[model samples]
Target: MSTASAHAPAASVAPPPPGPRTEPLLGNMRALRRAPLDYFLAQVREHGDVVRFWLGPKPVTLVAHPDGVRHVLQDNVRNYNKQTRGFAVVRELLGQGLLTSEGDFWLRQRRLAQPAFHRQRLASFASTMVEAAEELATRLDARCAPGAAFDVAEEFNHLTLSVTSRTLFGSDIGASVSRDIGEALARVQAFANARLTQLLPLPRALPLPSHLRMRRDLDMLDRVVRELIERRRADTGTHHDLLAMLMEARDEDTQERMSDTQLRDEVMTLMVAGHETTASALSWTMVLLSRHPDVRRRLETELAQVLQGRSPTVEDLPKLALTRRIIDESMRLFPPAWISSRAALQDDVIGGYHIPAGSFVLVSPWVTHRHPRLWENPEGFDPDRFLPELERERSRFTYFPFGGGPRQCIGNQFSLMEMVLVLATLVSRLRLDLAPGHPFVPAPAITLRPRPGVWMTASRPRAATPASGTGQ
Candidate 1:
């Protein structure tokens, strides 16, 4: 047996991952644009975990298995870079911030931003999240009649925008400011998505309508960010907000600080990343909770027992296991950062398939989270799957809502803490039910947003006491 194994023929080279026929030059671009989420889901389901496709002349590989995802995101992360078309579009808005930067520069920025998101620092921001949720509850109470429908998506967007603004910049972003930023981000995201999907996008310098508008929106974002930075600089007292921390941070090796341009990029990155994604997650959670009454009941019970009608603090987080699980499951189902792409910096093998250099590697949480082999009842909504024991049995890459490895989201802890506090505060006080006849559709853009926005009816919780006041 040993002699036979030693002389065994070499393993056969596996053929490339299967894919559907593509038009010569168009190359599946139409299918991608028609329904990106559905298209990707079908690719993985029909073609197995590692599927290959083309975008015109460019090669795109969809990695749907956890092991393969680990290979790209963690094990050989250096061989993959964020120089993909998707990130290029993001950079048009974010500049050379941590989200878009690569190499040694990204390392320096990550280190500088790391301390501000330390557990201790995030603990202090709980009050801000609770306060924002309380204000939202009060506003919803006044605007939404009992059993009458309103846009929960809009409300969550406003609430999270408020929370992120106060926590990151130490200033209240009022309705007007939030509206300005929101509109600008929407425009930028739309343009970016168009550019990402287009086989050959128009040049930005062409003065085309979309390009012109994107530039204008980008300028608006810059103005707001610079204004915030200027305001922080003019203030006399030291603040503990993220902006202050970033401003004071210095490279231990070089003793250099981030310039104003760098500051603007980082601040804008925080605002966009911190606000929009959390709001999308919360909105989806609310929708899921309303649809799954049993889960919602359990969540309400957990909130009541842990919060006791008081605001949730950072200390209360671990105890609110169900709340965290609900958020996790919601993100699993409808992750805001649903799909992320990386460009291969060098040729490598992932899951036994050859990946050529400069190829686009797609790691979609949307597809992997529902992979049949990894998840029992893959389409079902069950938060208990995230119970510690069960979660420990799963692969780390199976449920990466905040992504995995070093390039993972920087403010993940901050987002989770904020969601927990805000969800606890609001759910304890109000019962949100999806409005009758309102369709639930996921809009896959740069971030996942509800297409027409989630419409819901807000009412006082049946078991809760009358509100004496809002927030702690």
Candidate 2:
């Protein structure tokens, strides 16, 4: 032995990161199933940044601090990939799409899909969004009387799915086809969410009732994709939709176009994520506004000044400051994609803890957005904090609802523009208020949508003057 260690005890490795007490083969699964968002927040508050969790025999290390999140998501992102069980569940629904695929394949697909969401594409999409909102407002007027209770969440979901159908497939997609896609996706999402919280989840190969139902829905989604492909192949005219972009894009290296299988996978991914997330985000924004009439009033005033008795355009987005801030604040409080995870490719250190190779690393916007050390009055709804002057001073990774870095959501700008136009058009023509005594607890599934949905009363607002959107 060396002189320094001749009489000393052999060096010992550090103990594992702290976590809630657990039982053999069943650690923390019950807690996670009962209320995952609350459970995650509690874990971070009690155990510090690097909290270890066990679901069954596997250990999951949660990196809750902003620096660690940035490290895994941005700085050394290649060292981690979406190979965790969480993403595996998403992959089961979305196939080998950009959200689940990794390495060279993901890079190639991302490049192929980039131009579909460019500025020009978004301008056309914006027109589709505003037109859809105006049509929805007209429908609501025909059916919803004063004080009539309606599920605004469901309405927003239907509207977003319609817009997505028109923007993704084509403007000619019929209402019946949109309804079929919506019904199938709803069942598939429920099945995926159920799989996420199961402790001893049975194999899908087994003939379980839920598994059989999910397979039917998956098959339906496949048929829809096939139909879209055949239709696009037959048509020779130029189009402004995602399916056309993917079909037309050629690889720089090989000059080869995407195959039918690749198109199917990307379409499935976009159909699920592009609409559901936007709808959830918009519903949450409406709920926040319902609780804060003053914020709603200010938003109306801004819309009046910017729009001036007309629907908002892509060019008017810059002038809608308060409208954008309200959306930002709502997302901070209730992000649609609340939690996401990745698998470590090798050993690494995060938040001063040893994260071993093969460790499952988790990050949650729900927790970090309310981190006391990073946010002031983090639970309170305050839109002013998102003003450019204040937002510039905050940490980059501190409030990542759409994630960050290379793998950040590819359709973020498209989603934001759609949301702004939709809000401007609807809030000026219709008013939605939460039904009295309705609870607002979020159902943390594949998306963080409200549980039992956001029930509200809808009515058209009568403007006192042509220039004012604030009158009811």
Candidate 3:
């Protein structure tokens, strides 16, 4: 729907919402560079829900209110497009993938890719999710030793990458291949993210060391993805996964076949977005669980009562209430996509503030999810806040970790299921304690990664865990 029709203007137009005073030329860029997350948090806290700030010469309005978030994400979504500097960085790797595509083209691609995430498909993949988690748990058993530390963040990344490769591309990616793909994706995204935050980013055409290395890494990823696409194209009804759907799906009206480029873009989009964001969520959940022993105990009790120490299935997801809640609450605290924005296609009003055409509106979950007006003990980890009754009492936009509306992350359920099963499997077998003296600061890159890695000591749980190891 058009923004003009969706939101009738009030009698008088309000000027851009109040914000920090700008400097001569740098604007709020310096402050943002200094502490990105804190700058966003402070903007919403100090300047009300509709906080305006300048990044370089450009003006940015952060819509921290749920009502405003709804306006931008769902109510008048058409008026906002993914024409932001951030998405441009994403296009460097994703091309015109669904995550970065806009308008009718995005609509067409969404229609084609939608079936891969159908309820039946996801349900069928539950065993795949649990089996992958079970493998990770078995591996962790060997790694666990009293007082020994390893990066659980890395472990989750490998697991999610494995799951994504298998489910999305119908390829059983070996651990070593998963590691290689994960590292290559990291390089490309890390470079893109660094360039995004630069006050004056160097042109990609330049053969700087970082740029050259990223080019190599991106080419490596492209070759791998293209091979998978080729393999699927030659398949004879052997696979019915996402890649096959994208390959075989025909546009309803025009009946246009998906191009090689479009297929590749969508495949990479699912791989990177699915793998990275889910890993971030699981890592944060692990940290939160470790910190909150009471909550962890409650979750353990729930899993014990619900699954009876067996592998979790899709049927068990509902009964694993606290397990799902922990994932929900953890994402609220450390949203992987910490920064999300949409360009104003035309003049619009959100939260009673004028958003002139061409300006950008940022609906950061990082800010909105932690808004004190919207959440109690905004910064504290509390899973019960997501209890069905409590969730029903709140506006949906208030807690959008996977985002919302038509363009919500397509892999949301896929990510959630992966997190729950992984959490259940690992928690049932092992205990992860934060390594002494390691900070929990989040490093905001493509995703809000656990900075410097979540170093943790893993040991066999002496309590709650079943003694049979496999938990028969």
Which one wins on TM-score?
A: 3
**Model 3 steric clash total:** 0
TM-score of 1: 0.94
- Model 1: how large is the Cα RMSD against the reference? 4.3
The residue pairs found clashing in candidate 1 are none
lDDT of 1 by residue, 1-472 (tens): 0101224332244345578789989998899888989899888878788889889988899998888888889878888999988898889888889889999999999998888888898898888888889998897777557667899898887888888788888878777988898888877877887788788888899988878888888888888889888888889997988889999999999999888999998888888888899999999999888889887777777776767768888789878888888889999999999999999887666666667778999999999998888999988999889888898999789889888999999889999988888888888888888988888789888899998899999887778332322111
Task: Please give the lDDT score for candidate 1.
Answer: 0.84
lDDT of 2: 0.84
TM-scores, all candidates, are: 0.94, 0.94, 0.95
lDDT of 1 at 159: 83
Per-model CA lDDT versus the true structure? 0.84, 0.84, 0.83
What lDDT tens digits, residue by residue, belong to model 2 across residues 1-472? 0111224222233346789998878898888888888898898899998799999888898878888888889987988899988799899888899888999999999998898888887788788899999998887777567667778788888899888888887874677888888889999999888888887678999999899999998998999888889888999989868888889998889898888988988988888998999999999999998889878777777776777788888898887777888888999999999989999887676654667778898889999998888889989999999988899998798899999999999989988998888988888877778889778789999899998889888776656233443321
- What is the per-residue lDDT of model 3 for residues 1-472, given as tens digits with 9 covering 90 to 100? 1223445464147566789878888888888888878888887778788878888889888888888888888988988999988898899889999899988899999998888788888887788888889998888788777777788999899888888887876667776877789999988888988988887888899999999999998898899889888877786766766777678789999999899899889888888998899999899998998999888777776777677768888998877777888888999999999879889888887766788888888988898888888899999998888877898999878889888999898888888888888898888777888999778689887799998899888777655653232211
The segments of candidate 3 whose C-alpha lies over 4 angstroms from its true place after superposition are 1-12, 463-472
TM-score of 3: 0.95
Candidate 2: 10-residue stretch with minimal lDDT: 1-10
